[model samples]
Target: MPSVRRLRPVWAETPGTVPPPPGAPAPAAVAVQPGLDELGTPLADVTFVVVDLETTGGRAGTDAITEIGAVKVRGGEVLGEFQTLVDPGGPVPPFIQVLTGITTSMLVGAPRIEEVLPSFLEFARGAVLVAHNAPFDVGFLRAAAARCERAWPGFQVVDTVRLARRVVLRDEAPNHKLSTLAALFRAEVAPNHRALSDARATVDVLHALLGRLAPLGVTHLEDLADAADPVPSDVRRRSTLADGLPDAPGVYLFRGPREEVLYVGTSTTSLRKRVRSYFTSAEKRGRMTEMVRLAVRVDPVVCATPLEARVRELRLIAEHAPRYNRRSRAPERMPWVRLTDEAYPRLSVVRDVRSGTAHIGPFASQASAQLAVEALHETFAVRRCTRRLPLLPAAGAHACVLAELGRCGAPCTGGQDHADYGTVADQVRAAMAGDPGEVVAAHAARIRTLVAQERFEEAATVRDRLLAFARGAARTQRHAPLARCAELVAARRTDDGGWELVLVRHGRLAGTVRVDRRTDPRPVVATLRATGEHVAAPTAPATAAHPEETDLVLAWLEQPGVRLVEISGEWASPVRSAQSVRDAVAAVAVDLLLPRPPLLDDVPPARPGAGAPSAPAGPDVPAQGARRTA
Candidate 1:
């Protein structure tokens, strides 16, 4: 008690007040100080713990982890390392032993996963998680935590494999596997299927990926997290090419280094946004990626409306034949099913439509044209013989087997009366002119008969033929009116509180303009009229304006709220037309025969003028119409 009299005050001996012993070095300063919020933290200030686990098998839910290894890093400097062998509480499989090179004997005295996981969790606390194919390692840790009744802290995770796929090109590495990526980046340590070795390799890979992200403006943690979405360096360099583009509806052309158009595309809004998107991480198509990398400049054609943009895009694609454009570039080469201009007409699939010929299609392919022809022949007694038939039958002209089976009128051999054959020809012409009611009904009856007999395969063939013809017939009916019109004006409301106006002249896109809600549209309408383009009218004997263009115009006109502002010529679909009947029957057949929901009507009857616009019959059809005396 006498010796303690001289003791120093308690405050003097406090840890904060205490001084370091002599000759001891002061504690080194921490290079990085993380922010209060991880999302707001700078990439250089945050700590990352790249982890890897060797598990008993592929599935985390069913498999137990055997080893844990992690490296804690800040500012690309390793602060600490953790490694432990875990006893899975069961014998490790032979395949796992061979894969990870960890034997059962090595885990004999090791701590159980329940014990080892706690230490790893503490080591990785308050740090971002990183791994190659992160799902495999993080998933196992989460499953283990759940089984151990431990609260698993949610951590921001980064997958190096995903990062590598975005950062490295396919030609640079055959795949994004750990070993391949480690070798490609020349990591400080090679992955050997062991936890620590793989973890060390992944750390190097993480640093490499971070270095790559710095050039992409990834200075913040959130930006670093999004580094896996890659924008190629070349594409990124050319992003400024879109800076001059207007944020309006338009078509854009990406020009290559040689100034050749590389790609043609259209957007209904913000040409700048659409063009720049091709150079960003969001563009993932491999072909488009290559195209963007090769693109040196972007050219935009601003339009007053989206319809005009679409039409311009189609026209540009057809003209340039851009290597990157796959659709609408070859509409001129599409085939058509034509009824020949002869005494006795025969069905033929021809690429070049002659003037004054009754044709049924601008079919997608020769096969589709042939299918339409076959469906037509199955229903009508049209002459199938290729021979030229005189007004009166020639004596020695041999009749083909089609005549013997009553599939054709055999006008070439005089096997049928002239007036009778002419009647069949009229029926064929009516069907070709978008009146497919009789043909569709006959095929539908045949399909029902085949189903009644339990011959499903044969019925399916007939059903497919009917569907094909129905599709072509519908297209013809929808587009033929627009093609035949002299001039028309239509308008539809846009999503952004504007009006889209389309002008058609001679069945082709004449002009398109947009009217703002706050502005009077009279001036714009006058401007459109002044600058309206002139195009060839849809006429018989020649393939009409590209069906694709006509279809586009038709679709816009058919929109629910579209208004017909003006029309010089009549724009109509036939009343009680065969196309309407075909659509009704085909709709029901598709529901019943195809793998779809139950039919709306169990037995749909062919209803004339039921499901189509009403237009007068085409000019080529006889005044008598598609109706025939039985």
Candidate 2:
């Protein structure tokens, strides 16, 4: 808010030094600031108070204002001028003094902001406030008003810099800086660092910017805002690229100059409006802005249902790996914890998983998969060593430290015979194969003991592990049935009583369609099944598609109101009782316990009247029964 009088801001590009005011436009947000509402007023009738300030520093919270200068004008005629020097109650920085020529000595007897702010506010009242980068001036003014305990009048604001950028072409003006614009327009007054001279230069610049708006039919104040931030003419004409795109749910790809997909996106309501936003101010991402500049055409794939649209978008992103799309790009790299095929099977974290009944994963990262494996190791006497076990026990070989600590049965060194180790493997297999009770109960007991012993940090670690196990287990279980199915048909009611039907095969969405309200969906479902893509039988983990895709399908199937219309293969997972898992682990139970399969849910009932404290909870929870779409 400070300059020699009102022409320039001294805080130019001082990153992070000054905080923008509340509701200040995000930098990515193009032209026009918020806080100004009345744009309908004719440009000629609007009064503009072009103000500038000199401050002790860039920060509004810490800085003090030293001078204020503004010129009020309406219809190209001057109305009034407000000029003042204030006692900032502090010495000006040497750099600020050299920059603005305002010294501490000159402010010795000047009126403080407490007296100057009210007069300035009064002078600028009822006028549309104007400044080059209005946030700076408006922000400083508002801060001063707050310090003076004054209520700031909500005056509509116009930022000349933003306006100039929209009105003047890049070739016409290299930049939108006031000094540059003032020189370009040949203003009678030139900006010096002083506030009054700068404010005078801004006045000329604002008028010249307004003049450029005439041919664009932007004469009214409202027109000024609409006219702000226009894309280059070539880019503007590219708005035609959105033409012919359906006003319905679909995936849209922005093809670059070489016909390469620069971006992939979707719109559930209208592809036209969403796609058009890219060529307008609504699109603020720098990369997206550049993408629009290079885009030659928009190719759209319209889907009959929203779910189909979403699924298609994911598949397209995975297939093309478009540089502009940020998600669903390498889901195959997600980790899984599996039991290796060996004489003594044990936990292993792997990235590429085909089929395995004794596996639990699609964990978000390798670390999480490892944590889940560690949680499993903590609960069962499963072997921890990764080396292959010998066919026959080597009685003379020594066991690893893990075996001594009872964390493993030491199958590698033959401390436990194959038959005995088989028992541990079965328990580990049972937990990963969808009966999670033993893992849960054991962790719960362990967490309860840690909390009672005041080892909260250790308790929290157990909590995180348990929750990670719960997430992987729950997510995996959700995908299991859908992944196992060879073909399935399902439907959900749309708002209009119509049905949205989908065709899925081996966990990948094959096809989908929406039926009109009051129309029979039976024939439509049959047609969808007939026309659906031919899916080959899936391998274990059981999905033919990416874990992410299967997860989405499961989520849609599990949503309330969706009901299965037909099926070609198994859709139910056998319910293994939690009690069996607990009994299997009881033989190896020591102290640190775990919870049932749903790590975040299902804490065992506390012992009644035993005076035993409750178990500490793991960090998360889980729940679900596969929907009976039989």
Candidate 3:
């Protein structure tokens, strides 16, 4: 048995320390035992064959692996290294060629996957595999294994991606892309996007992240694999979604055996990757424990835009009224906080769901929204209990004691004047209008008025407020584009094994498949299902995306044999198509909004005390709910 030991640093083992053997091993040679400590726990006695693959596209199921890089390490030392570019029986795309600088001319005489697969298997045997987003690379390898009619050389996988997210990152970073991590770690760059280069980068990033997190008890391969946030209740022993998902924006419904929705979600990106995330993320694991256990099949409705996704999600929740979706119902039923038009202004609670109504919340919990409303009232003095104001004290009625507490202006008892309080109430009303442009304009006008009156000190304060409002408006607008651009495409194996979908956007594709007695089926099937179904329906705005829409996609599809043909040339009759597209898109967007619940539709009510115990129309409900929900 190999002795477990600590790994020496990479710098300590310079290049040229080991020479290539006279001949490569035979196809069926015994496989190397992989080192489980590639993530840098104490060096284990086991050996590791660090591996990397350069592929034609991002989707493992659809993309072919063109290059492979593998290195054997044991006792903290490099034992051997293997690298090659396999000639997939297809033309390489130009952009992929550019990204990897692996031209068709260069691979003219390379070995096929059949020839390379066995060597890789031999090199990787017995070793725990390590890679950045190991699942992605491994998915490709598994696909290759299927092609060759062999089991994926049985081994555990350690993902640098998972490690980075769980223990490496300090806070919620914007992204966790391998390139981004590579840059941060200052990994060697022989040729980025190439199999060997990326493998080296993966190793470097793994080292850095492990060095930072080893103290957190991540000492072994199993420890890291189990380190997932939303740990899957069902381990994918056989059926992986690699070939089962369509790479598009769409709503996905997780169902129990009897067709009950365990959860509803959307992915504008890769469905397989997104689904894998739920099973792999550490934090998301806690939130999805129950759903994963109950999930038997996943259903999806594809969309053209993210806005459409959200619309569909809400519609589905309302239509199906799934037991999993409880969060969204409260907000739908609760009353909204409205600012009254009456003089001396009072806040009222309205239950009707209509536009043009300035409201705060329809929170799930009335008490929470009410508390928020109270807190806001304390800060801004918005009205709480609405009534006919400025009335003479009723017979035997003293005064609402809250007036003295500064909660109410005491208009009922004539304790305070109206004009003085009216100005403050007006500002609060303007703020509650919930129109970004209106709020910004209102604040800007206030600033200008203060300046004209020579109240420089006050003018400065108002100016700051205006700036803050403008910043907020800008942020909202920024998110608007993202929300609009976001869309999903959902495809899953049907009862009889067929697939269906609605729309897709941004050229991303995703889908899922069942595991059964089949030959290497991922590559051909995933792409075939995606092509036959809906192509991404880019909205008008998507045509003008930054970096030039067509060019970017074309660049991505530039490898040999990859071609992009204009499918629909700005449809002559686009009004209906656009609407259809938008609706489809919104369905997916709504799906994205479907709360990522352990169950589903977990958005609580926005109004406090709106559900029970009190008159539903109490003005306190909306204000309270909004604050609590917010």
What lDDT score belongs to each candidate, Candidate 1 first?
0.74, 0.74, 0.52
lDDT of candidate 1 over 1-630, digit per residue (tens): 111112122211322235679999986766867555434566767788999999889999998888998888777667888899999878899999999899889889999988888889889999999998998999999999999999999998988888787678899889988898889889879999999899989988777776676665566677766566467567788889889899998999999988899999999889999988887877879999888778888899988777778888888988999999988678768888888988778889887767676776677878878888999889888877676778987778788888788787677776787788778878877877756778877987887788778787887787767766665665565566566567777666678777777878755788887777776655666677778887766564232455666666766665566655556655556554544554555565665564332221211222244222223322211111112110
Residue lDDT tens for model 3, 153-200: 578777777768775455544578888887777766543777877776
Least accurate stretch of 10 residues (summed lDDT) in model 1?
621-630
**Candidate 2 positional error at 75, Å:** 8.9
- lDDT preference between candidates 1 and 3, better one: 1
The number of the candidate with the highest TM-score is 1
Global lDDT of model 1 = 0.74
* Per-prediction TM-score to the true structure, in the order listed: 0.63, 0.60, 0.40
Q: Evaluate residue 301 in candidate 1 and report its C-alpha lDDT on the 0 to 100 scale.
A: 95
Compared to the true structure, candidate 1 yields what TM-score?
Answer: 0.63
The lDDT of model 2 is 0.74
